[model samples]
Target chain A: MKKLIAVLTVLLIASALVFAGGNGESSGSGKKVVKIGVYEPASGDNGAGGKQETLGIQYANAITPTVTINGTEYEVQLVIVDNESSNDKAVTAASELVSKGVSLVLGSYGSGVSIAAADTFASAEVPAIGVTCTNPQVTLGNDWYYRICFLDPFQGTVLANYAKDTFGAKKAYALAKLGDDYSVGLCNYFIKAFEALGGQVIYETFPEGTSDFAAYVTNAKNGGCDVFYSPVSIEAAALIIEQANTQGLPMPILAGDTWDSNVVLAAAKGTNVSISVTTFFVEGSTDKQITDFVDGFKGYLASNATALTNNGGNDEIAAVTAMGFDAYYVALEALKKAGSTKGADIQKILPGVTYKGVSGDIAFDKNGDAVRNVAYVKKVDNATGKWQFVSVQSVK
Target chain B: MGFLQTNLPYLLAGISTGGQYALIAIGYTMVYGILRLINFAHGDVFMCAALMVIYSASYMPLYISLPLAIVATGVLGFAIERVAYKPLRTAPRMSAMISAIGMSYLIQNLALYVTGGLTKYYPPVPFISDSIEIFGAMTKRVTIITPFVTLVLIVVLVNIIKYTKIGIAMRAVSRDFETAQLMGVKINSVISATFVIGSLLAAIGSTLFFSNYTGVTPTVGGMPGLKAFVAAVFGGIGSIPGAVIGAFIIGICENIIKGLGWTTFSDAFTFVLLIVVLMFMPTGLFGEKATDKV
Candidate 1:
């Protein structure tokens, strides 16, 4: 038995040496590889949204496999790490990316986790371009963090305006998830905009893991609000929609980009409440770039059922996916302009880097936030339970 | 009338949530009663039941799927006992408990691997999930039926424990494990039977609980499980009726606090109740004082 165990250990060590040699020989054969890290939650509360965002990055990588820097072609390798949608885990995942020596980082669907890892990225001198994390604090103090999506203040204002202008709502009720930075920040901005528009704002919050919304819906109904806005996680949104429908609430439901999920859409199906949200990208656009991208994305989904499953098992192009795709391209553009894979070089050229992505024109402000003002307003048709493009609103 | 109208829905919601907790707490109380060990894996067993329903319900209808899931969960509970606990039965009690905690982690990680840590939507049952109005308060039919079903099951369980030979053997074992073994009672079968009953209740509780929540994540059972364990401790660790009452009080008070806009303190309040109960009455409301043989 001892001899057999010794023989097995020898075999394992021999195979390990052979594999290491093979890896070295393969890497030495060709082009230089630059790693672009993807730090997203593949598990935990934000897992669903994180997976969708990764889908976009994966698609973008497939389309543009390599980037040219100083007339030398370098293969772009994506180093994906699951943050587990937790603040503590985000720090570790961010460090892992830094240790991988990535040129640029893209990711993190939730704002709270992004802000948690902001310090790690900064300390490591790694620039991370957020995909859909909308909280202002994610990029406010963290010079290493940049986003390709609009901040909560802009999206919140657009939502408030849509509620006032489209529905002519006077009284608005805002519901937010407690302790969630994205929900709380967006809800606060929405309240400010609604109050500035001379509309009465009623706000309520539910703690994390709250499964029931019956009482909250009843309160909203009793308050006689014209519009109800809840920028919460998809799980909470589903409960809210179902309870609101059961209670026979008449008011229209409004939310931020996070509400633009197939899960939310499936929940709101056959409900009395007409749901609308301000998102980054609206599918079926006439723009050649967007149309081509959508077509290509559909083809990718057809060939890859696993990606389709990650995207809620359909071809519906989620807004976060489009943002993720844009963030990857923008990172590539920054890398190209900087002519170096060093983190500081990418950060130096990231502000001036502009790319007309599939979503929209991507550019950043001094605060390292996306400078775009346009938000695509999509409404779920109560009859068909499908999303329909209403109009694009620009926030000042 | 107006005050009652505003508060009636919250009260009903509390009762339903309480019923779910009571069902799960019964499992905790029963296992603690028999083994004098806190079965930390009880919550993970509840989680496994829900996951079983999620994967099974896709291929089969609830009527067929529900029973199969319950039996499978029961078998899993039995298997866990045979593998993790039965070996350490003669060892120190602390060893069995540590094993239970380790088993909980193993089960949760196993579930995470199987589901890939994705939250799957719980398929809504037709008749049970339908909403009905009660005194101007609109709630699901499951809410009204939960407490009734829990009470009926409690009565049936009590009868089983009091009347049947297996039940008498169980009582004897809980009273004195060595004495019961010396009296020619089969210790292994009775312990297996205890796990079977506890697991069955957990399976039923998972069905009712997830039906309301409508989404099953990997850690879905953690909070409910902790709260249920607290409920068991709050009532009296070995007492069934005590667990049920403690669960209702916790559920109602927490919901009322949430309604009053104190959401953060609502969960914190359960632990506060437990601490107060421990300080004032260390053995719990229905716990019998045990004197160790020095």
Candidate 2:
């Protein structure tokens, strides 16, 4: 029971934060304390993402104890709101963060979640940078919204191009989540790009979350497509991959950024499992910024260590934390260049400013997308238990 | 022939799932027949059984996990009866119903909290899943074993309920709890035993289900439990045999619909079938009225 409880504790820290979300009277904290809110799924479905985001925020705050804004140093205090990794909850967290009068908000770690929070940020005019949530809808409509990761269109193209150029895949099968707009959207984009690149998708099937995917895996295996592309929800991605491997189907399993998680990789590890994901950042890069993040995060956890015995040597590539470091870095850079901590001043220059961050050089386009097109394609190293970024595929 | 043979294994696998649904439904039917209340929390109990199975089985073979889960669930059922239902014996019907609903939510979310909401993989018994040809169809060993096991369990369960002393007490309680108590039968033990038996069957059913699916989720019991409740009601709720029949019909129909590529409406088909049966036979397929001898 305790082993189960320990695993659950690691997962449910955010849902506990969610209790904090609904209960606390709006502190209406003044701008003196640099409050940044994170909305992540803490308990259900996407709890891992939510928990990882907390780590990111804590690490970033440790490295930069106080954010210098317009020459005044404001100590960072992150107020987290658990979105339960749900779309509706993400919106609620965003509105709650605004109501609390935080200068900035970070998180809600998937594309669907970002879309849910988009309208609230648009109305409030707050700057946010998501970690691994790569949907285009997050940054497109809101002037105040931006992400540290690349968008779906580019990611879909990356997969499409990889299938074409690398595998020489003339025919592929698309297995996606039926009711999920995120899976369907990415699958559609990938199919469109693949066909345009002189490839063919012979068949496509949509499965519900409860649908046992073994049957569908068999169908794709029998379909004899050069590849099987399942743009799945983060929640269901690992299960689908596991079943695929168990069925002994040999098709290369390619998926979206939702595949970025330690549990997903660990489950997929050492099974000769090959999955391609366009991620925000890949580990093992010799970049100084990457090294600093690795060292700084390890230090933060070591200084606050309690449960080293629990993780069984699980490395920290938790999305929310890495994205948090980048988000704080982005915000800090904006403040440095603006020479003022005023929200209005920082918001104005955010679109054009460029800074080298953990993922890569960060430059927001007019639509608030990163101006650069660097997408890290990584496969899990079953031996090393680390994600090694293969060729850095640039789509621009 | 290749297409038929290729798909036969999957189709047979579907039957394995159907078998568990039927077993769990027997409990629902037996409970429903004696007590008109549908135990919504039965699914949550199944979810609880799954957590126990995962934890207890990690240190031993899965063959050991099945009995451990069943016994644990039975104990849980006894506890549930004492804590959640016994006090509400004289409460309003609405109150009991509300309590059951609340219990269902509590158990499920607690599981979501306890299990970290991640799916746990339980691989099959080694070398047990090799396929064999039958009627020009290739099927896994599980597909061959599940139906026979389900039938044997059903027979054994039915025989005990019909012939045993406790079975007589259960039958007497179902007819009239006060009268049975007047007859010096221990009413509390009978009710607790009934619930214990029901939970035990569900644990067994869900274990078979996980064997085929290779995992159990917090929500795994939700749909299966609902269908079992429906099965119980369909088979003349209180009648143990009726629930088994109801289970088969629902299980076979669901798989056939999925097999036909009309999965979008598979759930609708079961509900429609249940509705049609309830409209004409409100008392269910095998229900009998209790006649008073004054």
Candidate 3:
């Protein structure tokens, strides 16, 4: 009886191994499915970001040409991999995508993951187009890298302009999560810009994970700043804003696109002071292109068997849909111009192709950054749970 | 000095965080002192309590949510001891320890898979986010609530172990399970009760932790769990008071490092303290010597 059980166990183990091996090799040389890899946190704190980026790709593929990369035609496919919101996972995902023979990859909102996968993409000779993942090092140190978004310096200057001219705030306090590259980068950039604009950053602080904010809020109250800035997660932002409201602290809080979430609105609502955020798209806007993208994204989601529309995700989907549409069509237009799927061929032709995208007309600079549209700031209406357009400014 | 004064609230916040770690550490110390097998899965017990708090808060009022979560955690601790533990009571100590580690991984992964590893934000309470000022220092309502609640819990736990009948039984079991069983003190029941008390404390810790942290993730308990374990060893693995002291020390030390502008060193600071303590005192600050029936 024991021998029989051992045999069964071995067989089961063998079968499991076989199934795992098969799953990895299932994509045959069939229809020219161009497996584009995605590098984003499919789980953890930034899970929403992964879905947002991928969902954008989905809508772009739906509306754009059948296939185009460097002026050549080929069916497009995206092999989604979850970075689990860790840099280690990003490296693993990049390697896996390379092995799967993907020529292009999209991803990685934070600088850490982009850096992690830099060598992998470079070694594989595949291009990585970063979406809103801005830090100077993301594209500067690597050859096979590009980004559709502006860097921290640009974002910082835009925000500083709003603080100085828009809000008329001359003094501010900055609280940054020193542990993260994104937070530190954004904080430094904002301080430089704000200080240059003659606004004093009176006080600055950093704390570990979602701890009580009363002390910090009180400190901000003490510093007597007209504005308080924390480039933090939506979860952290909500708690801090809620506590700030509770303390009757009257400083206006300013932050990056990280503040663009329904939960932030939910937390800030009914509080004495309204929280404002900067980001790419505002959901409740009546702009023709903005509404068109939202409607198209919802339509695409409704048709796709696996598309999702929950957890304040439609807004996220709308943002990505715009980005993805730009990426896909740009690649297709490039492919038609190149008349080949070869990396070398397409790389040469990419500098010449131009297409007016959902965000703006896409044109790559010599350094490989898309010099497209500007980023806008939005305010959350606590009662309506919608984004109200506040202002638009260029990162440059 | 200006930076320190400006960031003093972060340090104070760290102290309150240390207080929560103390509560979780006590549970680890109490369990380890008697069993000599690390309750590796203690953090999951803490996570379960937080889950219970969120789930129960939906059905019951917010006031009742904490107690309900504590009770649920205690019940889970008892169940874990009864099912996964009791069968290995006669097994080798290493086997039990391995089982404990395996159970920890199982619980954490299960939570990760089920919760999709996302950070779940807690719905704000009516008056919980309010802040109070002391000596010109700002204290959040939850911080004030947490420290006082933790102190009260420590007192009650101390009283329960010092004067109660179950306390005597637990002590007897810790000394020698065989001897205690021979003396007609139900070994399983006493151990079960000990786990229950430890879990209840962990539950309270979790509730307080989530109240301040505002969100719970699969890996949220990882740092706290490992830190609480280090606290247990620092205080004396089997010593309850030792664990609490160890936790507070680790917490305070981490904050001091963070306050010093070496924020990247925050994760490593506590472990460095542990290594220093172990180098000087191997038995842990309060760990006892127990005989093994070889």
Per-residue lDDT, model 2, residue A206, is: 45
Give the distance in Å from residue A345's predicted Cα in candidate 1 to where it truly belongs.
1.7
Alpha-carbon lDDT, every model: 0.86, 0.70, 0.72
Best by DockQ: 1
Off by over 4 Å in 1: A1-29
Local error of candidate 1 at A62, Å?
A: 1.0
Each model's TM-score? 0.94, 0.86, 0.85
Clash count per candidate? 0, 8, 16
> What are the per-residue Cα lDDT tens digits for candidate 3 across A104-210?
77777566678788888887777777776777778876656777766777877788887887679988877776556777888899999999888898544554443
Ranked by DockQ from best down, the candidates are 1, 3, 2
Q: Chain B TM per candidate, please?
A: 0.97, 0.90, 0.92
State fnat for each of the candidate structures.
0.35, 0.10, 0.28
lDDT of 2 by residue, B166-221 (tens): 98888888888778889999878887888898889888776666655655567767
Better of 1 and 2 by DockQ: 1
**Model 3: runs farther than 4 Å from truth?**
A1-31, A62-65, A68-75, A199-219, A283-289, A299-321, A342-345, B1-15, B56-68, B82-99, B125-139, B181-185, B248-269, B281-294
Chain A fold similarity by TM-score, each prediction:
0.91, 0.84, 0.84
Residue by residue across B70-97, what tens digits does model 3's lDDT show? 8889999998888778899899888888
